[model samples]
Target: MAERLTTQQVAEQLGVKVETVYAYASRGQLSSERAPGGKGSTFDAREVAELAARGRRTPMRPNAAGEPPAGEPWASRPVTVRTGLTLIENGRLYYRGQDAVELAARHGFEAAIGWLWGLGSDAPVTLRVPPATAEALARASAALPDGIRLPDRLRISATVAAALDPLRFDLREQTVQAAGAALIAGMVEALPRTAPDPGPDASLAARLWSRLASAAPAPEALACLDRALVLLMDHELAVSAVAARVAASARAHPYAVVSAGLGATDGPLHGAASPLAHRLLGEVLVGGAVPVVSDYLRTGRPIPGLGHRLYPEGDPRAVALLDAVGRLDGGAAVVAAVAEVEAAAGPAGRPALRANIDLALAAMALAAGMPAEAGEVVFAVARTPGWLAHAVEEYREEPLRMRARGSYTGPRPSEGPERPEHPVPSSS
Candidate 1:
């Protein structure tokens, strides 16, 4: 159900004055949105509760373990609920509690990144590009050898080339941010093109769809891509985001942080799941469906696309991605293919067993002619904005660089009374 809380209501819930609530919003601690027709600011009911919950955690581990009845006490691992997946949980995101989904939905791609960076949504995409790097971009564009197909590779390589130039060592935050933005914008502008007509919307997902489709997409397809971005935007510090934020907590620049994010994403456990889903979907798409799914069921395998750790009901992002794609004519056959496999698997019991975002997203990507490997690209690119936001947050309340003590769990050898095993024999 849709629920909006008044400022006063939100204040009471948090035990803060109404003015203090607005102050928090202003400082980027929490967010509020002005309703349509500019009537009034609306605070989300659940978000208020979330803030209360966060405050109550105190964000620190207790020094002592809880004592058991007899002797030893068990130490509990410190638990902190990550805020990165706000996009997924609430179907919205905040730069500093600012609405990212709304801006991305309403504005252009560059505008959305700007919104996340606390810049005006309408700012120009071109920021300062170091002169030497700009020259490198010029040289790379000149050397493209004409008619090469892979746009992302060209973009990625060009970025690696340009950013590696000696000038990049400046390490200033403003400098690094500009360099990162330029690398992205420059890549978009320089990618191999047939006619050079207006490409995708230049927004994150639209560009991703363009990358996958390899051509200008229709309006319907673009809308679908937008929804995909919102859905996959953030996913609760999924291992990749967590790794990236850990690096960022060390004052890593935006590009380096993103590179780390991409590295973590490249790992099999995180982003490769999507490509695996593509293969699973392909199995269903071929061979008239039933025999294949039955064979898959016998393998004692958890179906690839059908489950996730979070999202008890289902991966909202998966549902959102599928909704964006609409009913592609042959899509029913694929869904049927997966459904049969699920039927064989029997009833779902845990959130971990539910089909997650990766499956449907893979289907959407495949139907659109995306190469399987491109799933990582699609996911990583779509998630970059969200990752950047998390990086910024980590910086704002930078965690103290943590240290650890070594446990003496190594090994020990001691003289022991001899016991003979010679008398025993195997049953065989």
Candidate 2:
């Protein structure tokens, strides 16, 4: 064997997809060798390890105008996106200088997920739960109501129960991620199904559709939807995932942790908007696009199908998904109608109020014959992997319950040891 290894070998050694290894090399975090004949590259194992040892977390991001707050405004240390990228700069989306979209597309969902989780692979993290704790979670899961829907929600409860087994706050990152995955899988599988079996290649969405309704989904479109999972997998500190991480930090059981996530997800800001967008589409069709756009513009109200918070330049995910969905059966005309309506409406800074990824997903899911309620389920299912990955990340960095502060806006309402309270005057 030579003293050094090629880039391909380095990828094999690291157990990451090839591009990820190249990403590390590209970022100068991994050493590379110039080939004699051509443009190929190689790596030295010793050099790679040395560079890794020196590598560290120092998050850098653009603080562009109108960017959202990371809270803790008064704190000296501004939070940086160490493992995630937010607010694209100079037409680039980078997670530590690795092109996120390219990586996501090339390596599949799990690879991108691995990078987020700190383990950097599809590597399994198995925890040997003590018999006592295991038995306790089993009993609790059994005791849950028979008819309760939502597999992920049940897992939230199960994780909570599992945590009560007294081994929940384990510090290792792999342990947390693996345990969460296992818990979620159990909940999904255990749900009573009344439909045809999802084969090995069937996606979580495809499986969910079959389980929720007896309706079958097309194989090709379902695969696209599966890749859609990869696209939706992570965004920096989304509202629901924030709630999830907060709960995890408090040592909530995995079930309880994600339950907090699900609760937050129910709000209009996150999960509910997709269905609303769907309804808005229906209204636009019924009311006629011109009239609807005219009225909406007059009121200066935003249209549902157009625009997003993160992508002022346009959501890359939305662009990719819409393009992918365009290939679906009967997709083009429907998409064209929606696009025309949007272009007619989006003028000035509003930009035809272009529909984001959620709208496109809803459209595709509808075309695939999913029920009105199914989009949110698909969103939740896809997003959980990322949320749990983040939870594992947060768990690794700090000890439990990282003392989130709130503004004390109320009047000085305090009681002394003697408990001096304004006596209530009773009118007799």
Candidate 3:
């Protein structure tokens, strides 16, 4: 009998998440069979090795028109976007050549945003909205039912802010940067506060903590939140950033660019990961990680907040944030739960999945006594600056340049009944 490998073994061999191994099986790139007693699926070791070899093969280059080869789908063509914002290389992340982890430790979120927007790193950024604008946003948000999620409130608030700002359409560098700061502030302020307002003079993270947590702000917790904001401020060409750039390519205003980005950010695979991870960690903290992980595996759900594709070794942002989270009063327990979850998911002789930023965000939320949706709120607010940065970049490009030609995959028009052309009525 040929040797068969478990899913974890195959994932380790391919240097991918276990979920990706199932994806390969679903796509017919590999085949699977029932293991003994039908507990789990197993794959032929030789077949898995062949699939890995194929994945390592060199990809075809685009032709003269910068398109995929004939008969290949247009979606198969890689889009190369030039960016000076952020870089993820060798399991490390950098914002414009500066080490992101170092920057987060040494600078505030606003300072990082200033640097990313081409302003000096030490440039003072005031993330405040005019009193009238704040009142209007509060009223508008108040109109929504209390049951609405924080992220939805943020989306609605962005729209309201855009409507109220007559100068939102200004795409000039300084103007957009100013508007971006205020937009972030307004989004944070619009949320119904769970604690007393930290006042406008407080750091953005401090202000945000008031909204997300009912407890008074602790110095270390506030510091962790600030670091998280700086670490998440931007990632080069993320899904939300791409959506924002697409809006900017059409010359949309900064607010609309953020709205587009938010639309893409609300999905489970993207911005919502943090909240899911939060719930996952909460469950682990209660009933223990082993059974929770086993339950997730039994249901074939990809463990939330593990194994980011961009960081095979580990997510640096997660490392920095998790380290900061460990210093929180009760954070050590939560961090231990995260580790237990990781260990439970990866057995002996398998590559252990590393925690991602979402997991770290969840840890922060759990340790800080935040609501389940706190991580999602943090993600939305933190990434707003990033989306705006991309908007500024896209505004400088040729308008509508991000548009792509669609390849029709439906039934051919010729296959349908041909309609007779109707004569145009003459204007008498």
Candidate 4:
């Protein structure tokens, strides 16, 4: 008989969690069998070692004919986009081959944007709107009813900024980079400042802090915000990034590309998670995490900001930002609340749901005394440069390559009402 390893042993061997061990068994990547008396599952020792080796090897790529290697997860995807910007693998993220966490730690948000855009790491990246454009944005923003969400303000600003830019259609690399910087600047500047302006020479994080919070930021709090911005800058082919790329494929201007991305980001599963998490964290802080977590599970609602499919082990961005948030003066309580929520939700003998970036964003917002929607605003502004970076890549591809052919599932022509040989044209 072959040696058998317990679930925990297999997880340790694979450098994953017990949940991931079960996932591997379910996916047929590894096999498991009931232990004595059906107590728990055990894996064959050789099989565990082989799976670990496979995980360690670089992922196989498609051949010259573009056929994916056998058992590739993305083999069914019809359209493949080649990019040099970001990569997410082995539960870690990389931007242009540099570790994303390391980049966020070492550089500012603007520098990260410049780096992602293929601009040099030291490139002079300034996010500033022309005074005339800023004024127009302010006027447009003022016409909106009070109490509009921050993301809506960003949408309006993008539209107005587009209208003001005569060269918005230029797809040249430098032009796109310039427009992206200005668009981000305009979006941040368009929000009504809750605190005094931090001045033009201040970092983008300082400028954004003024808009999100009424109180002046401590140095550590400001650094946390800056880290979040850099970490959220680009994620490879996220849903919103894909939407932005599709618009770019059709030769839409940079502003329209962002609009498409924003439209996709307004849903609960994406940009909206932060606000939901903020509310959840507030409840957890008021009541105990046990009751709050129990209530959510009892109501059959998914706890927001818990899991991310991309990072099965854990989200490095969350770990990084949460560490920064913990450094703030009153941040320990919020961080403790988060830890309690995680512990209550995971419990023992079940898959533990690790915190994602949304939860970290919520913690940052709560610790900084920013409003619930502040996290969503931060997400939108941070991802804007990412959408533009994707646009640049998509622009270089064949026009409309992302146009997908629909698989007809509706009633066939024979099953529908008979059509006339010549359809009548409608006349007014």
Candidate 5:
């Protein structure tokens, strides 16, 4: 029989308290078996000796500010959640092995959706809002006050659609695709239209333009917006997509998954970036780029739309969409302003700061005479398809597989709330 060491022996060998030995066992750092005749738990003697030599018992100490040091690299580790939707690397975005930039320029958003939805490139695409669904969204949205934000209006409309869809709970592949299309279409049709309807066969960009801006439909501007939507469709493991997947992992109905995604998108650091960037662009146009950018830097705030962490060189999506914007009428002025901001806001001696998709989206809206808030609406709507795609993937996984394990740091069950044994001795 292999030799074994008692808990006390193991603790002494590792130079930690006995309680720490128990803690290590609880954490699965060391395994033990019940001792013969139930004396106590015993660990493999050889394993204990190896652990002692390795000095893993060195207590993890806090920094000067009392913050604990970093632990396991769970956040950055390469764990798998199989997806072929979009790949982001070297500042480029790809959808299921095809270049996103090329697709945006060559095909409109419809073809891109077919690719993302696991359908072949030649699959027929049809997206439509049922007349009843549109009417229901309109009535639900009309009940809200006029000042409600566009995303909030979208949330209310989505809830209405969920309530109306009788087959929303169906998780079959075909049912999911049908439900996703209706949800996206309802969101678009519910937006208050300012221009005349562009007819049923119009591209989503054209339909959305009527709702967002009063400017008459120009083919170039509409095409620019279409490419923007296609490019923005999906980005792997983005926070909002993770939120949608988490909901879907719980087998949530399609509408619930979308609602979860929309909730994450409302966070200022994410979906709101476009509107903030639009405002920054307006400020640069009015106040002169150099002074406005210099002022923003002095305040220690990130210059909106100037840099993205994921793209060290630059965002390819921004490059493609901004190029399209530059090709549109009256786009040269916006391009010049963008160039000025890039030069002025960039850090000295470092690589030139690169513009991100938010910058490109803001520039597109400004050049096209759309309202600043319209960019945020566009982002939310464009990202809906990607969220649904993640939802579909999550549906196939075991329920709650994404659930996280908590490492409790609180007092043990035996150690209840502190109470002086002798009533604190009547401290005066």
Candidate 6:
């Protein structure tokens, strides 16, 4: 058995007061056991000596400026990461100093993207996918397994497109913007199309709509879908955006940055939220609202489309998109079902729960007669511009700067031999 030492003996060996020894035990730096018959606690001599030895060998490490960095994980605490892109304030979102809601309402999705990219609103938003590039992306995407989701197919296409772009490593503003536009256009054209292409001059919404729905969409439905894209363009520093920035910080090519964002968006709680919300909206559209709401609530899961933490007063973007939905033909059933569901989900005092952007996208998809997963496709395409903009921003900063520091909680490097895998044979 390892030798044991009384608190006084441990304190003397370590040149610390007895109280300091007690503090070490309390802090788990020292292991102690109680003695029988009201005797004082004693520490394992081996443990105490090992800890002291580690302390002596390990010198304090501070930076050249002589200040030690914080040890706590930033994830558990609120941290300020500076970015001038999108700002969420007073329950409203702003993209580069313009109100996001107003921008979505008054301008096209590409115009809002220009603003995020530091281009003046009057700057032209280009959507031109070179014929050769589009063909290559199509061929690559077509080879993916049928069971893969649309976003995964886009990710694969991104890889192939990046491989083809010789100037992909060019971090200049004009070059990055050109690459971003071609990538978005290629992704849209590469998506499996059902309805006829509205031609090259068609708006992005028109082009993407053809791929998503078999039937033609009403003009108002196209407007609503376009607005949804604008609203989703940038939400200041989302998880996927952070992932994109991390890649950009490493100076990864723009297509690679978007590939990173797409990878992060594949998570259920992030970009995939729209599809789940789409499913709920479909059930409500097919079944009556009350029964569907009851059945969904009975499962003890929060309704997917309702409420967002950032918009307690209600998501203004959702309000804006839903207003456009109101203008759609045959939109009453969807609007009414949404209203009944919202009514059934009466708030319990905290500013009143409201439908979020996911619900808005789902409503738009349903009203436009698109498939349940179409909302996710729209989200991925819409967010591409913002991802590239962030990549540009990251390229100007220090490389590999977003790395996280971890606190050591595992076995120490100086730890003595671990317990034997098989105890030494009892030499009886």
Query: For every model in order, what is the number of clashing pairs?
Result: 5, 13, 0, 0, 0, 0
Instruction: Predict model 1's lDDT versus the native.
Output: 0.58
Query: Ten residues in a row with the worst lDDT in model 1?
Result: 68-77
Clashes of 2: 13
Model 6, range 1-428, lDDT digits (tens) per residue?
87889888988877667876776777677888897565898889888777677645544344324453233212221233568899999998999889998988888877777788888777748888988898898787777778677777777778878888999999887899999999998888778888987989998988999989888777788888899999999888899899999998777899999999988888767777878877877787788667877887789977878888888888998888888887887677777767777866765564435788888888888888888788888889999999998888887764555655467899667667569788898889
Q: CA lDDT of each candidate?
A: 0.58, 0.58, 0.86, 0.88, 0.83, 0.81
Q: Which is the better candidate, 1 or 2, if ranked by TM-score?
A: 2
The CA lDDT at 90 in model 1 is: 44
Runs in model 4 deviating more than 4 A are: 1-77, 415-428
- Output the number of the lDDT-best candidate: 4
Question: On residues 1-428, what C-alpha lDDT tens digit does candidate 2 reach at each position?
Answer: 45777777766654456776776777666677786676688787786555433322222122323243222111112233243433255544554355656655565544555554555536423323344544555566567677554534444545554555454556465556666655544444444454687753444445555655455656656556655766776666778877877776665655566667777767656865666656655555567677777877789876664676667767777666667667778667556656766776767675456667677766665556555545566676667666676666555443333444355688785565554378778799
Question: What C-alpha lDDT, on a 0 to 100 scale, does residue 326 get in candidate 4?
Answer: 92
TM-score of 4: 0.79
Model 2 lDDT, residue 3, Cα: 71
RMSD of every candidate to native, in Å, equals: 15.0, 15.8, 13.5, 12.6, 9.9, 9.1
Runs of candidate 3 exceeding 4 Å displacement: 1-79, 415-428
State the RMSD for candidate 1.
Answer: 15.0
Q: What is the lDDT of candidate 4?
A: 0.88
TM-score for predicted model 3 compared with the true structure:
0.79
TM-score of 6: 0.78
* Candidate ordering by TM-score (highest first): 5, 4, 3, 6, 2, 1
Which residue runs of candidate 1 sit more than 4 Å off their true CA positions?
1-108, 119-176, 186-207, 327-344, 348-354, 397-408, 411-428
User: Which candidate leads in TM-score?
Assistant: 5
Candidate 6 residue runs with Cα over 4 Å from true position: 1-80, 347-352, 414-428
Error in Å for residue 317 of model 1: 1.1
For candidate 3, the per-residue lDDT at 296 reads 96
C-alpha positional error of residue 71 in candidate 5 after TM-score superposition, expressed in Å = 24
1-428, model 3: which lDDT tens digit per residue? 99999999998887777877787788776799999998989999998887666545535444535553432222222345778899889989988899999999999998998877778688857899888889999899888886999999999989999999999888898899888888999999899988887777999899999999998878999999999999998888889999999999888999999999999988999988998999899999999999999999999998999988899898999999999999999999999999998889886899888899999999999999999889888988989988998888877654555756465699766877776699778799
lDDT of 4 at 418: 85
Cα lDDT of candidate 2 equals 0.58
